[model samples]
Target chain A: MMSWLGETWAILSKEWRCELRSRYALSTVLLFAITTLIAVSISVGPAGATPEQRPLMPVLLWLILLFAATAGLPRTFVHEEETHTADPLRLAARPSCLFCGKTLYNLTLLLVLEAVVTPLFLVLLQVEVADLWSFAIALLVGGVGLAVGSTLIAAMVAQARARGPLFAVLAFPILLPLLKLVIDASFVAVAGEAQSPALGLAVLYDSMVTVASLMLFPVVWNP
Target chain B: MTIKQKTFRWLLFVWLAATIWAAFFYAPLSQGFAGKMGDAPQSSRIVFFHVPLAVASFFAFLVAAAWSGVYLWKRRSIDDHRAVAAIEVGMLYCVLATVTGAVWSKVQWGAYWNWDPRQSSIVLALLYYGAYLSLRGAVEDSEVRARLSAVYAVLGFVVAPFLFFILPRMASFSLHPTPGSAEMDREIGLVVVAAIAGFTALFCWIASLRRRVLDLNAEAG
Candidate 1:
């Protein structure tokens, strides 16, 4: 178990090094998030949501992050295949370790994305949080769930012909429930704490999907 | 066409014919709610077919996922074929469910499209299976296609509950009924069960035929 964790760490560090060197995925994802944010903020303008629209900000925030994820996260797996590094990596790393490392990497990237876009959303879109604690936990847990899901899907889609949009098509249905939970969590956070189970539910969803991803990863990663 | 199989086919046709008859003529008119022709007996009749189509499609997806899990374990091309067959047959039923549910929604809720949780969940199921088909189309090798889609089907198994169960229930504002079985009249409930059984059998028949076609195609190739 210790060795497995160590191997996972190794893969994650390698991912960081490669990612930093290329700056390919992070840049694309961040730019997409920022671009979407800017366009949306420009549309919504100085005035935030109308008084009747209670859940608009959280909905918009999560949608931006979700779209940005689709724009970039698949690159984590697709790049390995494109670089012809997949075969060596396949032989060298255990499937579970590789999946864990890549998921952690993707989680980091998603967090980076959430960090950059979220504050901009707050300032530019003027999204107010009534409960900061739930908001943070929701974002973290949701990001973790999306990261794990995208990692498995990335591996699946990596082997296919149409790599890019196909990733979103496959990822959307699977990620949507988790997305809803997080959105609700964010809503409750903004709606002033109604004691929502959305956060707990998101945690449960993340654990379930994470376990399923781990069990299914070897089949996806292997030929 | 063995004698037994032929008889079974004819029986299915007659059984379905009987279900239609019972749904329309035999079953009591459902007490409709407040609306124009919400008093209409036909309003309740949609339940017979609508419930069955949704139930069958859900079963179809379950079978697909089950076959997919088996395929991953056994590495049999046939299991993959079964999974695909179940998905295709289930997709048709799922679409029918969505459409029928929509028409009923218009009658009852006064909207063809409400983005109701039920509607959203079914559309997502369509997309989920549609993505499965697309993923299969994208892969060149049969072995790899079977492998990856099987994994995906299993992952979908993980997601299906959230789509079918969690999303709609959270809305709590859904106009759809919750296990109306208890409140359902005996005759209507019986016909609904009959319809569900009929549709499920039809699903199996269609799926088996699809599997056979794949087997033949594989053999020819």
Candidate 2:
């Protein structure tokens, strides 16, 4: 157990070092999110939207995050495959550990993104999150859900042709339910509607995806 | 085909044809299947075909997921063939259901697309298996494809319940009519039940035939 944690940590730190050196994924995702935020704020200027359309603001924020994640997160595995490092990494670490570490990296990356973008989204759009608790939970849990689904898909996508588009194609449908739940959660946050089971469902979505991915990642990551 | 197999095929053909005829001629077009909501009563005949196709498609995907689980456990190429065949048939049925529902929607709800919860749910389900097919297409090696696709199939099965059930129901109201509402005609109900059974059998027979063809290809190549 200790060895498993150590192995996972090693793989995670290896990912961090690689990211720190290149800033490839971080920069790509951040730039995508920032650029989309800019376009959204420019066209749909702060306080420009009517009250009828205001309820959709948080949903738009999530859409930006979803597209940004899909654009960049699959590189976690695709990069390893591209550089021919996957085989050695497979040999060195257990499949579950590799999965855990990669998912950890993705979760952190998404958190970093949300931290940067959410405040900007709110400020630029002048969107009032009436229920900050639900909004925050939705971001955190929905981000975790994205990380888990994206990592498994990244692993699968790495083995396939046209890795870039296939990652989003495969990941999007699986993430749809989570996206629905998150949208519901954020809708409440935007509309000041009464709380719903959206957060609980999002958690359920995360756990189911996480457990299934953990069980199956070994098989997917292997021959 | 064996004699019994031929006999069953003829029976299914007759049964389904009768179902279609009855759907239009025998089943009464009630006042409103959607009760007060005013979904076109004549359009409600779509339930006879649409419900069956939707149910069968959902069932076919589950069967594929089961076969995928079998392949993962046993690592048989035959199981993979079965999974792929089931998905292909499932996709066919899913598309049929979508078209039928869309046409019915246009007649009943004044749009080919209503963005109804049920419609989105079915579309999401279609994409789930669509991704499975694309995954199979992208991989060159048979064994690796089977293994990786099987993992995804199982993952999808786990998520299927929430996708099919909870998320769709989260909306306060869906424009799609509920099946067992009290105002629906009993005659319509009977035909729907019969059609559902008939279509499910048809789906299974077609999927098995496709599976046999796959098995033959495996042998030939």
Candidate 3:
């Protein structure tokens, strides 16, 4: 088990190192996120929504995250293909471990993005975070779930002929439940409602999905 | 006639008899909503068949995905053909399920399409698989198409829980009633179960036929 953990960690670190050196995925994801948010804000209006209705801010924030993830995530795998790196990586480690590593790496990147964007979202959208801890916790749950789902989906779509646009279309319906949970949690966090049940539900979703993906990825990433 | 063909014909006959008997007598008619249909006689009859067909279609999809996984894991060409056959059969069932569900929903909910979670999710499934087949057609090379479709199939499974399970739970706005045997009542449940049995048998039969068809196409070409 520890050896497996080491393998997973090694793969995760390798991906992180690769991304950091290139700065490709983070920059594209961030650029897309910022541009989408600006478009959303403009489309919604400069004056902004009322406070009572401010709960919608989290929904909007996650939507931006969703679109940004959709737009930028395929690059994560495509880079691998372009470099012809996945072949070597697959040969060295178990495919299952590789999937775990990739998922963790993707999840971490999303968390970093959320970490940076959440506060910015709060200020720009005029969302009152009743409890900062709970707010972050909910986003974390949603982020991890989104990360696992999108990472696998992005890998799948990246292999297809039309990489970028196909990823968005394919990922949207499948990620609807996670988006719904995120929207609901965001509502609870903003409205100062009891955070326990909503947050708990999101966590349950994350755990179930994470475990399923871990087991399923071996077959999915079959060489 | 050969024994295999005889057995197949017998199975087909039994399935047809079971389906007809179950639909008419075993399953009781559910009363439609108050005004639109006005408690019309024979209105609740469709529920028995509709629910069963939808469930059978879902079962076919599960089989398709599982087969696709096997194809990738074993890296066998035949498994790919099996997966494709199951998906095609599943797609047929899915269409019938949607049409029946829509018709049933119109009777119960006063709308032809209620953005109800179950209805919406079924539509999503249809669209996802539809796009999948389209992708299969668009790509020319057999190996490439197989590889790409296998990936899409696996990804489709990953996202399924979110659409079918999660969104519906989260959507407070949906008017779709809670799912259960109780919703349909004992009489309805029994009929639906019988119909489901019939549909399952039919699905297997159709899958075998489709497999043979594909082989024949290959031979002819």
Candidate 4:
């Protein structure tokens, strides 16, 4: 387990270094996220938006995450393909190990996106942030759900036709439950309503998806 | 005729007769969760059909997943056929379940759509599996289609527990009754069990039919 964690960390750091050096995925994601946040804030209006309108925040946040993750997924494998290194890597390492590595990297990328956007969202949308700690916790739980689901789906849809939109088509319905929970958690967190219960529920969603992906990744990743 | 086909047919006929009898005769006609709880303003006798269809959807997906595992493991043409056949039948059952659930919602909730967790999840399940079938239909290459569809089937099965089970438990506004609470009475439980059995037998019969159809297609190819 320790070795697996070490390998996963290695993959995560490698992906970070690669993204930082090239700025391909990170730059696109940051640009897209910031643009979308600005657009949503304008649409909601700086002065007009209120707590009743806050449900829209979670929805818009996930929409951004969905698009950003979809855009980032192809990069995850495309970089490997362009370098022509995946074959040697897969031949040398366990596929489960590879999946673990990829999942960590994907999670890191998603977390980075969330970290940048959450504060921007709070400032732009005037979110109350019932408890700063709980809000952060909710974001962490919700982000992990999106990360793992996106990783598995990205792998599945990578080789298929129309990988771009097909990822959304395939991933959206499967993601509704998690999205719903995240929205609910954020709504409660921002409104200062049912904070504990809502966060707990979000945790439930995260655990369910995490356990499922852990069990099933090896099946799809391995030959 | 193959031994499997002959035995399956005989069993099918027997279960068909049994379901007809139990659904029409043995199942009780409750006025609503017995007396006070039966608030639907009408008889709750639709339980037989609704419960059966719901259970059949579960059984159908189980078959789909099992066959998918076989296809992925063996990479055989016949297993691919089985996997596709099960999914088609599962989609059929899922549709029936959704329709019946809609009707029940209309009667019980005073509207056809309540945005209840179970209702929403069932609709999502139907759409998801429908997309699965659509994916299959879009691809022309038999081998690529088979392999990709198998992967999607496995993913659907993995993500489904979260969609159907965990999410519902977390939500607050759902009007649908939660399973396995003290609210359940013995009569409802017994009828639900009988419905499950009846529907499962029906599911097995239809799956057998679909499998035979697939076998025929394979042979002709």
Candidate 5:
């Protein structure tokens, strides 16, 4: 068990080191997020007084995150494949270890993203989180789900042609339930609702996708 | 086709014909909401067709996913073929269900698309399986395609219940009625049941034919 954990950490650090050197994934994802946030701010213009636009805040936030994720996450596997390092890595680490390391790396990237984007979104869109705790919990849980879902999908699509388009096409439907729950939870957070069923749903979605990814990843990774 | 299979196909055809007849001629039309259109008229009959096709589509996907799981375990080419064949038929039935539901909705709700949860969920399912087919096309190597798509099929199936069943129930507003919320009439229920059976049989027959065609192509190639 210790060895396995060590191996996973080794893979994670390797990814981090490579990413630091290239900065390809980090810059592209942040660039996408910032560009999308600016476009949304310009169009919506600092939370117009219209009540109709207020409800769209959560959806727009999630849309930006989703598009940004689509831009960046596939590189976790596609980069390995592109560099022809996947075979050596496959030989060195267990599939589960590789999955854990990759998922953790992706999760970290997403967390950093949410850290940056969420505040900017709130400031620019003028959206208030009535329940800050619930909103944070929603983002945390939703980010895990997004990372888990996208990592597994990225592994599956890494070797395929047209990786970019295929990743979004495959990832969107799988992520829909989680997105719905997160959007709903954010609405409740915005509304200052004491009880948010959407948070519970997000937790459920996170568990389901995480477990499914764990069970299915070995097959995808081996291929 | 073998003699037994040909007979089974004939039986399926007859059963489907009877189901359509019962739907239009025998099943009582559903009453509309109070102070609205008095009854659903002929448009309600589409449920017999639409619901069954939708159910069959769900079943086909389930079968495809099951076979996909089996392929991953055993690495049998036949299992992969069966999985793809089921998905192809499932996609056809899903599209038919969507079109029929849209037509019924247009007549009943005065709009072709309302983003109704049920309708939207079906569209999402279509996109999910459509991606599966596209993935298969995009992969160059047969073994890699089989393995990757099998994994995808299994993963897609796992998420499907949440997408199709749970999320819709959790949503605050849906134009579609909840199952068992309105008690369906016994006569109409029987027709619906029969229609479901007929569609299932039809699906099995089509899937088998598709599998055979795939086998022949594999042999020829």
Candidate 6:
């Protein structure tokens, strides 16, 4: 078990090293995120927006995060296939180990994105959270759900003909339920409602997707 | 077709015919406001067909997921054929259910698309299976397609309960009736049961026929 985890860690570090050198995924995702945030902030200009628009901030934030994650996460596997490194990687690591490594990398990338985007969103949208703990939990759990979902979907579509559109099309439906929960949790956190059941649902969604992705990744990875 | 298969198909056809007759002729109109629509409650008749299609779609997904699991475990081409066949038929039923439900909603609620939880969830389900089909089409290799789609089918199936059942219930307000809230009269209930049974048989027959056609095409190729 220790060796298995070590192998996964090695693969994760290797991915990070490659990413650091290229900075392709990170830059693309961050650029897209910042652009969307600015556009939204300008269009909905923090001060002039009506009261009805307050509830929509969470939805907008999630949508930006979701699209940004979709833009970036597929590179985890697609990069390997694109550079013809997939074969060597497949040979070197067990399918499960590779999945673990990719999933961990995706999760880390998403957390980093949230760290940057969430504060900016609050500032730009002038959104307030009554319960900071609940809001943070929502972002954390929701980020995990998004990462797990997109990582598995990225692996599935990595070898497909239309990998780009296919990734979003496939990931959106899978992520809808989790997104709904997270959005609701965010709404509640903003509304000052004693942290609602949405947080529990988000946690449940995260665990379920994480487990399902782990179990199903071997088949997608090998094929 | 074998004699047994032919007989089964005939029986399914007859059962479906009877269900249609009973649904229109025998099932009592829904009570209250639904029964009062257009002075004759003709719109309520949609339920006899609509609810059964939804139920059958659910069953069809279960069939697809089951066959997918078998295919993954055994790697049989026939199981893959059956799995995709069930999804195709289920997609048809799901679309019909959505259209019929929309019609019913327009008549009952004065709007066709209410973004009701049930309505949204069905759309989500359609997209989920639609993605599966797209995935199948996108992959060129036959074995790889079968394997990957099977995995997707299994994973999608595991998620279905949460998508269809749990999430919809979490919505605090919806126009659709919640379970245990709407009471069906005995006659309508019986007709609905018959319609469900007929639709199940029809789904099975169509899926089997689809599998045979797939096998024939494979052989020819």
Which one wins on DockQ?
1
Measured by TM-score, how close is model 2 to the native structure? 0.95
In model 1, the Cα lDDT at residue B179 comes to: 71
Task: Report the lDDT of model 6 for residue B122.
Answer: 93
Number of the top-ranking candidate, with lDDT as the measure: 1
User: Which scores greater on lDDT, model 1 or model 5?
Assistant: 1
Q: Give the poorly placed runs of model 2, Cα more than 4 Å off.
A: A46-48, B34-40
Instruction: Kindly report the docking quality category of candidate 1.
Output: high
Cα lDDT of candidate 6 equals 0.88
Candidate 5 stretches greater than 4 Å from native: A46-50, B32-35
| Runs of candidate 6 exceeding 4 Å displacement | A46-49, B32-40
- Minimum summed lDDT over a 10-residue window in model 6 chain B is located at B32-41
Per residue, candidate 2 scores C-alpha lDDT tens digits across A64-129 of 999999988999999999999999988989998999999999999999999999999888887777
lDDT of candidate 2 over B49-111, digit per residue (tens): 888999999999899999999999899999999999999999999999999999988877688
Clashing pairs in 5: none
Worst 10 residues of 6 chain A by lDDT: A45-54
Residue A103 in candidate 2, Cα distance off native in Å: 0.5
User: Per-prediction TM-score, please?
Assistant: 0.97, 0.95, 0.84, 0.83, 0.97, 0.97
- In order, what lDDT does every prediction score? 0.90, 0.89, 0.74, 0.73, 0.89, 0.88
Candidate 3 collision pairs = B30-B44
Among incorrect, acceptable, medium and high, the docking class of model 5 is: high
lDDT per residue for candidate 6 within B1-221, as digits (tens), equals: 68998899889889889889998888877774454345546788888889899999999999999999999889989999999999999999999999999998888888999899999999998998899999998998888889988988888876887788888899889987786687778898899889989988888888888999988887786
- What are the per-residue Cα lDDT tens digits for candidate 4 across B112-205? 8777888878888887887677667655667767776787777778777877787777667776666654354466567677767767776777
DockQ of each: 0.89, 0.81, 0.32, 0.34, 0.80, 0.74
Give per-residue lDDT, candidate 4, residue B90: 76
Give interface RMSD for all predictions: 0.6, 0.8, 3.3, 2.8, 1.0, 1.1
The weakest ten consecutive residues by lDDT in model 2 chain B span B31-40
